[model samples]
Target: MKPGSLLARHVAPVPTSRRWLVPMAWFILLLMLSAGMGQLEWLFRLVEPDVREVIYRRAGFFALLGQHVMVVGVASLLAVLLGVGGAIAVTRPAGRDFLPLVSQLASIGQTFPPVAVLALAVPALGFGTLPIVVALLLYGLLPIVRNTLAGIDGIDPDVHEAARGMGMTAGEVLRQVELPLAAPVIIAGIRTSVTVNIATAALGATVGASNLGDPIIAGIVNGNTAYIVQGALLIGLLAITVDSVFERLQPASQA
Candidate 1:
């Protein structure tokens, strides 16, 4: 056999585990294309000035995007903290009775419509980003809390018994054994919350927080499909990109 054929025969088929690379590459390409579209005005003047203005100048799509990200990021962080703590609280023997109640409450928050949340929050919190943040945080809480509870509860009982038998304190077992094992599942919950909030944060523009939704709302007022598509595409791309980054950050052993 030729040297190439011999090498191919001897080397076990190269593992196919790197499949994520293909999607990651495609995602990067799409992001670059979106960025170019976002800045199309500088490249071509043939497009009508008014259309260019609508795409770039009037709406401040990039600025609005940044605001939306900040709002979602802050809200997601807050939701994770609250959800994790709440999960821990309700899991203890003394707090066990309240677990279902807390879970139901969080579920209620998630079920509430973002638009309705915005409307109610705006009246009390007034304009700007506070109302938006509150709405997003509330809406994002359930998944994190539910996943946290599931992760902690799903641990093998034998492991817990072994930890206790080894004279480990409750806090030590939780900090060292339980949390490390549960980290992957908990992170999965956080990933879900972050992605969901990214889309929901667009509702902020309805209450004057100024996000990518600005163009979509304006487009509806003027019956402009292009404007709506541009805004929706940007928000959708942002969610996918951020979720991809988070997935990459997850423990490789778990993946």
Candidate 2:
């Protein structure tokens, strides 16, 4: 028998379980370790004697979590609304002349540093969450706007023509057809906005808005590595959790 024929005859298909076992085992071990670390009250107390007081009595940790959520949520919401609207507007024939200009503006907003935007806004908005929210919103707009434009523009022109030929009103077609087909792409943009905003919102603490960044900045000032690690771990876990939840919500078809 030929070598090639002999090999093909003897080779057996690999099981799916074998393919997935290593990665799944590692992930499970990592999760167990992280949970154990998070639950180690004694370790936390030794590292930061005020951990319980800050997390519970003073409500600093929860307050920080809330601020982070609020800034990211508000900024992401504003970005989605403006981005979707701008995408629809620029797709129209009448708005073609302005598409490049609008896209350039959004790109500029993203290229400008969040810290710089926050610094500029502070004098006008003062020391609070407002400046942070504004900076996050500006930072978040480009991805959403670009994604929205691409989703809408990527739709088949023939589909639009067919809808019109069938006596479907422009509004009806857009509401029933375009938006649904583009939903996956738009949601992807939202996911990106959310993840980016979560990280950027940490900058708020620089302007005196309490957030996860508070611990990080305080740790830096006092040279406390434990505090920095604790804050970073919490922030990273929060982002991962939120991202995982969103991933679960996505349709299998989209995935």
Candidate 3:
């Protein structure tokens, strides 16, 4: 196939609306549950018969879900921009010398657990969403950086020559040729980063961030299984919904 056709292959054969059906379904269910948690009291009561209160009501579920999404969304956005930009920069001749240092730092970010990052950050940033965002951003960077580098580096050198031979400028080669071909891999990295951060964001509750994690932490503290179940179920649903969206975005060939 021609280089141009390679980019087209990333588009799914499914219709646009049809492609999103699965994610939309999951997202709707999440909204229903968050909005109507009280309706599930019988379900939770079965899970915790002895408990006086089976539902978590310190704060609204919908509000906590919004807080959770906001934290992960902000961190994931920052991670994608920095990770993709840095990867592209280091691959260029002018920035090649810094590649090793950047790679090492990204690796360190992945190796250190999010909880530890939170612990270190809380003192400096102080308890709240700021530290959680920073922790999630750092934690999410490695996958994106690694995959972006791998995607760009894996491109055949002949493709670059072919594009340049056609009078494409350096920026044009990157934008039209490099990024398009690399999109599948880069998207896969972002998918992983976002999903993992969704689950990890729950730890924010320990640091005073009012998120879905709040219920889980409170459940543990109060020995309330129902609360833990509610929080975990929502987080799992959110992750699955977001993951399905990314899966649709990825090229079928790569998937």
Which has the higher lDDT value, candidate number 2 or candidate number 3? 3
Better of 1 and 3 by lDDT: 3
Best by TM-score: 3
Q: Which stretches of candidate 3 lie over 4 Å from their true place?
A: 1-12, 252-255
Backbone clash count, each prediction separately: 0, 0, 0
Query: TM-scores of all models?
Result: 0.81, 0.78, 0.95
| Predicted structure 1: lDDT | 0.77
Candidate no. 1 TM-score: 0.81
What overall lDDT, based on C-alpha atoms, would model 2 receive against the true structure? Answer: 0.73
- Per-residue lDDT of model 3, residues 1-255, tens digit only: 443444334333667788889999999999999999999999999999999999999999999999999999999999999999999999999999999998999999989999999999999999999999999999999999999999999999988888888777899889888887888999999999999999999999999999999999999999999999999999999999999989988855352
Candidate numbers sorted by TM-score from highest down: 3, 1, 2
Off by over 4 Å in 1: 1-35, 38-54, 253-255
lDDT of candidate 1 over 1-255, digit per residue (tens): 321121111223333457366547756765564556656645333433345344534655557777778999899989988999999999888889999998998999999998888889887999989998999889999999999999999988988887777777888777767776677889899989999888888778778888888877777777665667677888888888778766765644242
The total number of steric clashes, by the backbone 3 Å criterion, in model 2 comes to: 0
lDDT of 2 by residue, 177-237 (tens): 6776677787788788888888888889899887878777877777665667666766776
Clashing pairs in 3: none
